[model samples]
Target: SDVIEFPSSIGKVTFTHKAHQELLKDCQKCHASPAGGTIAGFDKDWAHKTCKGCHVEMKKGPVSCKECHKK
Candidate 1:
């Protein structure tokens, strides 16, 4: 239920964990852990690959950079 902020070369991406929890039924949908962890290892390439992949597969969520990233 915390705001997970990930700082990147472009900007900081603030992800609302609580909002996702309401939409998704499983924790592993985005998170690799039940307790969650730092986004230090989650880079742009990783996000584009993982996030966009899921979005394309499920036909939901945003795949655009500006949609998730702050200008």
Candidate 2:
């Protein structure tokens, strides 16, 4: 196995197979190729766009810290 560092405007967000799989309800929901114009770019923003997007929109979960802050 290998570990890699991914730097962003905020900080590094590690990605793992287990962590990713646990979040998706279906493949086509967020991983479609050539993704639509509204789709998020990087992993961090993608997570916020998908996960936190629903949470905040529905007002059911904690307001994500990263959603408003840069770091």
Instruction: Tally clashes: model 1.
Output: 0
As a TM-score, model 1 comes out at 0.67
**On residues 21-54, what C-alpha lDDT tens digit does candidate 1 reach at each position?**
7777677766687666554467778778877787
Q: What's the CA error at residue 52 for candidate 1, in Å?
A: 2.1
TM-score of each: 0.67, 0.38
Q: Name the TM-score of candidate 2.
A: 0.38
User: Tens-digit lDDT track for model 2 on 1-71?
Assistant: 12234557675544343443455545455556533233446466676787567667767643556543333
- State the displacement of the C-alpha of residue 66, model 2, in Å, after optimal TM-score superposition: 5.4
Candidate 1 segments exceeding 4 Å error: 32-41
Q: In terms of TM-score, which candidate is strongest?
A: 1
